[model samples]
Target: MFLAILASNIRLVSHWSESRGVYDDICYLRQAHLFQRFGWHGLDTSLAHETDGYLAGKLRSIDFPNWNEPTRAPCHTEIADGSKWVMTPPPGTGFVLALFPEGFQVIPLYALANVMIGGFALYGLWRAREAGSLTLAALFGALSITFMINPAKASYSMAPTMVVCALAGLVTARLFVDEGRRRLMMIAAVGILLGLSASFRIANVILSAGYFLFFGLSFLIWRTRETFVAGLTLGLAFLVGLLPVFAANLVNSGHPLVSAYGGQDTAAPHLDPAVLRAYLRDTQFPLMVIACAWTALLWRFANHAGVRQLTLLVGANLALNLAFFATHPVFTPYYIIPILMLSLWTLLFAAVFTRGPVQGFDRAPPGRPRPPEMLSRV
Candidate 1:
């Protein structure tokens, strides 16, 4: 199932034109080129050149076969030098894209990378599932890949990041079940992956923050030495993964913590309150339905750690989306996608949770041990 989904994504990305209709695809591709020529220290002047039509006019037809002068839209920010303007969006996606050679078709490479991350996500889900329920693991693996290859986001940067976010979220939930050295290792893995996800899209930092709180509270409630060490290790690994982005910000924006996005005026009209309200209205109907069903199931299986953490993950992302819309009214369908993915995963967990324990499955299976340091009480 994973292979099939990955193949589909590869086919989809392979066929995409270099200059597609998606707003940020070209920007990332251009940024990738800039990164190839100049690493994180120097700014990419091509953005400014594109803005002024000089780059578009001079960019070779052979190089940019699909370049549309009338539809050409180049994004630039005023935070850096005019000649060295960088796109306001985060450079994480571009950095991955930088691995590809100039003028080479990148969507396939991008799709391939997403599949690798999706594999990690599927493995994490499988590892975390209760014993004797191979069916559930298979179901989740299929569902995750289906979401990954969804045709709606064929050319969007959000596609890969969504896969990464799903993996990180699943790894985080797994930390609750595993124990001792294994859980600590998972903590390090989660931090590193979450950091990578944040690079693709900075909004993922909210998800990372959500995980930190979730782990921290678990430690506080348990007050165990293992949990304390686990939390600190996770935090440190996450910071290490984020080092590149921090360094880039320091060099490009002269502030280590401040991001390139800070330079953009998000309060612009397209992203104002009215559009946010409309998006909010559109999403409420579906959410209301999910909430009703989700609450009933939770009441029945409130003891299950999976159920609780899934709720937190989905709720955190939903709140993040809502906060963004409330503050900046401009909306894009992609922004709601991570919420949708988490919601679907939550619904899946609710199904398994409400079913009660599968018959004949041991609480601690032979291959998977319930270590002494496991959060048995929580």
Candidate 2:
């Protein structure tokens, strides 16, 4: 099942078009071009920097009416004072695109992301060779890969975000079961990976909410030096991992904390029943339902403290993320996908790597000493 999913992903990726005429795609590719042409200085994504015809040609290929006008670039937003226009997204996706030559980026990206997830799936399968565990792993690995082509393909950022979520899920499981030094290291690793994910999609920063909340509450409750250190380590490493976005913000928005997105993109959050209904009507809604059910099940009956804590973390994360997206004024097919995927992946890995799920979540007979750590929220 896992091998077939990989082959299917390869077949799908092989046919993707880099210039699929998506506005976001053009902006991301332009960002990549800037980085490739100017190196780190590409942090300045101002439309004024388009001295060459690279962006113009791309726009023309898509038949954008204002292809020749710099200020009219599709995804570029004007600063509040109207001094200049800059790309809307954080620069990480662009940086990844820049790693590959232009006109050959998107496919390679999806391909690589698929392979990375495939590797994790294979490892999970290996770790759970027993009967019931094998079935769960195989089903999960299949869902995970096929997922890449549909919703994951909705945005270039999703590829890397998916990759980061997959890794964070595994590391999250390890953080609970492992002892001593290894536990600390997993905490830091998860923090770094989650932080770096924000560079791809600014909203991903919210992904850390459940984690910090878990750590904060843990420290407040236990008041242990261990929890303190654990929280502090993750917090500091997360900040370190956010350096790229900080740099991009400082360069593009004229301030490290300001956003480059237009008002609609960064508008204040509010209750939006319409948005909630939109989610309810979309395919992502089913996944959201499934994730909530899984999290609730684990939280209700898990025996292991680490597993229970992990479940609480996921439950918290799902609630927070769902609330945020639900109340926001807009909806998209892929908007809820990251959180859904993250929650599901974390659950799947916990089932695979931990010794403490209630009954139905896992029955992988005693696998040697399970890796260890636990606190709950995204």
Candidate 3:
């Protein structure tokens, strides 16, 4: 099933590439080729690093066609500017591209990698399932793959990061709810993965903050020293994982938090308060409403522990989106990575919950009191 999905995603990406020739695959392909050739040393030769003169000189040296005009600035600069150039290859997309061999287009590779990552997340979910509902676990895993495998828009760009975050969330949920002995390590690993996701896309810091708050509150309520230790371990792990992004930011921009692209407010200068208000009134509000309704319904029917975690995930995404909409001048679909992750969790919860009530599925092996319908329902 995993391999099939990977193949499908590859085909879809290839079709999309052929249909939409204007996409930035060339830039990503070039970046990957450069990385394959020079490793870290190739950074100086990338369009991002070189001046127009330097770029032109390199192009001339390579005997590449110039089309008789000045070359355009790198896509990263266009995304930062938010002028006529709105869409660009997302940073995570670039990272995936960097992994492929020279002369290979990165889009299909990205899609394929995302499929594999989603498969890993499915494996994690299957492993964490309750013993009584293995069938439901498989069903939910299938659903998760189907829902998460879409490559349209920024989904492909964000998929790798989302997969890591989803895996971390799944592992953290299991460790927290099941009271596993390795809970501390699991939580720490989650933090590290979340930090790595944020390193790929800094907007994920909002989701990480939400996870920390939820975990901290849980620890306080549980009043266990182990919980405290887990939280601390997670924090330390996150710090370690974030070092690369911080170093990059500090080197590129004068601030650790600032991105190489540019500041948010500086990107869209024409974004008046009224225009922002209208945008929120139209696009964001409807998305929030639908997301909230679906999340609430899913939580209402899910297992108690799963419900709590899903609620935290949904609430955090919504809160972060609202906060970003209010403060940030520019918002992209990739910025809603937390929402996408939470939506998957909600769908999985719903699937598991709905599956529990079916008679044949619930029938026990002759002993255990019908297994309590849905495993500790809230």
lDDT of 3: 0.54
Tens-digit lDDT string for candidate 3 (1-378): 645665666666655542133224444444444545666543322244443353344344444455222335334343233322211232344456677654454455656655766665466455444554455456445544554444234543455665665666566555535556776777777777777776555666665766677668869989898768867898898887777566555544445665655632354334358646655655334545666765676567555665566566556756755566556666544455455554455444334443344334544566666556445441
- Specify the highest-TM-score model's number: 2
TM-score of 2: 0.90
Off by over 4 Å in 2: 262-267, 355-378
lDDT of 1 at 30: 66
Query: Alpha carbon lDDT of residue 54, candidate 3?
Result: 36
Ranking, lDDT, top scorer first: 2, 1, 3
Better of 2 and 3 by lDDT: 2
The deviation in Å at residue 81 for candidate 1 is 8.0
TM-score of each: 0.70, 0.90, 0.66
Per residue, candidate 2 scores C-alpha lDDT tens digits across 265-317 of: 55688988788778889989888888888888777766567888898898888
Residue 146 of model 3 has an lDDT of 53
Cα misplacement distance, residue 266 of candidate 3 (Å): 2.4
Candidate 1 residues lying further than 4 Å off, grouped into runs, are: 1-9, 39-73, 80-84, 117-143, 149-155, 216-230, 268-299, 302-317, 342-378
Candidate 1 per-residue lDDT over residues 1-378, each given as its tens digit: 767776776777677666545456666776676677667643433343344343353234335543544234455465544334456556777777777776673665557665765675466455444553346556656656655545335545666676665656555555543344587788898888877766777776655655677678879999999769878998999998887677767755677797767766665524465665666676443643564456455545667665566566455545555565456555555555554554555444444433445444447767786666453432
Best by lDDT: 2
